[model samples]
Target: MGAVSEPLIQWFELNRRLLPFRQEPSAYHIWVSEIMLQQTRVSAALPYYERFVAELPDPAALAACDPDKLRKLWQGLGYYSRVANMQKAAQIVCRQYGGQLPADYAALRALPGIGDYTAGAIASIAFGIPAPAVDGNVLRVFARLDNSSADITKPAAKREFTARVLEEMPKERPGPYNEALMELGALVCLPNGAPKCEVCPLAAQCKGRAAGRAEQLPVKTAKPEKTLVPVTAALITGPQGVLLQRRPSKGLLAGLWQPFAFEGTAMTQPELDAALRTIGLCVQWQAPLQSTRHVFTHRIWQISGFCGTAAGPAPEGCVWASRAELNGEYAVPSAFAGIMRQWRPE
Candidate 1:
């Protein structure tokens, strides 16, 4: 251990949060938490983590879980693909490694959804193996400490930072050192503006602070702007229940359920009537509900909604889910939350 790693490890011992997984550390717990935390915050992931672990306690349970039920468990988390890949990896674990996540970093990396950062996290944090988990938080911390103007989004910058982390990481206390770096970045060395250097453990040794560039050291390429996609979602209600349709099995929000939706902005009366006829629903449109928006990674759903009564059998490739089923069983994504709020069943 050198100047950076040793002090960071000491600081981590005193300031690490009492997270659920850290309480009773295990490879499975760490692996699951790491996957959930990707592109998600700790506060947001907490309840999901508790619920997920309680429901799918081990690899065997995860491997044997019904795919729909699994999707239900992961509802509202977004990035549904992660959970799907996790299931596939769980099945592999049960067959290949006796229902336990592999201890070796390389083996963990080979699993679906487990990348180099996640593998290193599980290996060092859960198994006490000497590996470095360099995430965005760690990247920010190191960039400030070294005052490097490298574009952190590039692979070459990440590799260089990873090498630095490994070189300075303590062989005996890699876990604490890694955790401390992440914690410091998240709490003290925040990304938005000036870092709280007064409370930072590395204040005295930070090159970015010395150069008055702590907030500007870690440069990154800007991402493309999200495209707006106009959509009109319908709340087609009947005596049995509200009609919901299952999305196709291979794209955004795959295998999830949503209300009957049509592309384009708010539909004309003729357009709405035609849409209802296609679904075997013949009825007058009720009051117009509020329009809302749901943002995805690269697309935005500008949703307009209407409540209408339908008198017909459920259409093929769809289900007329009762209010009870919708409340207790169905896992509608948050994209339709606004429509659900304004829905008035007639």
Candidate 2:
């Protein structure tokens, strides 16, 4: 065992939070939690996790679930592709692995959306396998422990840190050891230059602390600037309720429903009328609603919204939904929450 094994595990056992997944550390539970936690916080993912597991408990159930229903279940949690890939993997598991996730690391890695870090997490935490789950947390811990100034965003640095993590992994207690490192990073050796070294169990052996660079060890490359996209959304409502259009099946917010919108600079009343006319609707524009912005990984949407009343039937490729139906049936993406909130019945 490496110097981090004993004390780190002890600290984790005493301080780890009581999460639902930890309470029932089955392979399915661990797998679901890991996927949800990718871009979401623990607190934010808790209700979604509980509801998802209750609806689809096992791989077979997930494989058989409806795609739209799955999207509804995963609503409000962005990155719909994660759940989509999970369903794909579940189908394969049902077909090939008898509806159970494979315990082997390679087999887990073969599944869609299960990268090295996620694969290692499920294998080690759920199956007691000796694998290193090197996520951002573990990377920060490793960089601080060795006082190395490596850019964690680089593949070579990740490979080197993964090797170091494997060397320190205790074979007999790999699950606990791996969990301990992750927990330590989340709670004590935090990111963004806010690590709490004074309370850290491995503070004694942390080289970054000795060198007074714990906050600066795990360097990362700067991301490119986001492209700005200006959008105008029409919240057209009539006897049927609100008008919503299903987005394209492949791009940002893929396969999700949103208000009828177009990307361009702000439009005048005549331009907006012409645009609505092109879509087979003669809408009388009411009051302007609040403007909002939503940020994605590669782009930013600066949205201006309008409330209007339509005079005719639903437009082509669009549907009118009641507020109740919108709440229960349609899986609208959160990107349009600002506009949707201002919607009113005719």
Candidate 3:
């Protein structure tokens, strides 16, 4: 406690940008923003935050929002399950507790989508509890301050760092203290190999300073390589509308609509012809709309999007979702976010 200075607090007090979630911090807003910010940049998150807050202002409002609309809003943000779960959690709160976000940490954590990080954020920012909001940003700050070679990706190291910070959290201004710690990491103790210490408040206490490996203090294990995958998507269309398949209710892109894609391999021209014929109607196949390259953390897809016209009745087992049906009535994964821009309503 004695190690921190007026300079540190002052720097944050004057420099911290007033954020959307902080303006009138509430449990709901803090929880939503924290989940959105996970593995996402602040600049990328601001619009999503604003739109989400506007659309779902409170528990009841969120509870009432169609899950598809929620997912659509969250489209392109990635890690979409987090958003979906929040809505489910909100509905649960509404049902069990009358639309109010629970105040207790255990209760909050128990919500469908609320995790440890989100629970801490809401508890500290909205409730002013002494709980520390330890996130990757906070972890990086502590790792630099202690100047230790701890692998941050490990749970034990994360828990140890969080416990120490929780001990030091100033009870009176817990929000400020939390923000200060996170701010330090986001601005001064940057990741990806650069840190600006000339303006750092904790410059004197940084163990990395003495050790000369500040950028390397909070180490992490090497990332595994992404396996390459090949998938093909169809543009099966007729008067009944575009033929689409509903993804199985569970797994990647679960419950979303997709064209009948030839998964796992490029269609040999002959295979392509057979696939086109199998759809129950046939017409000339325009050249593929160009191969769509989509990347996921565990897998990379070299997907080819084909344009085809159908001359007969829509096939069985495939749903012909119309343009009206596609706008807000259905939920699709962000992987389609880019392709939708090229789609025409007609």
Clashes of each: 0, 0, 1
- Model 3, CA-based lDDT: 0.76
RMSD of each: 1.5, 1.2, 2.6
Q: Work out the TM-score per prediction.
A: 0.96, 0.97, 0.89
Off by over 4 Å in 2: none
Candidate 3, 32-143: lDDT as tens digits: 8888888689899999999999988998888888766777778768776677688789889999998888878888889987778778778777887767678888888888
Look at candidate 1 and give me any clashing residue pairs: none
Alpha-carbon lDDT of model 1: 0.87
Q: Score each candidate by Cα lDDT.
A: 0.87, 0.91, 0.76
Candidate 2 lDDT score relative to the true structure:
0.91
Q: Pick the candidate with the highest TM-score.
A: 2
Candidate 1 residue-wise lDDT, 9-45, digit = tens? 7788888899998897788998889899997899999
Give the clashing pairs for model 2: none
**Evaluation by lDDT, superior candidate among 1 and 2:** 2
Name the 10 consecutive residues with the lowest summed lDDT in model 1.
Answer: 337-346
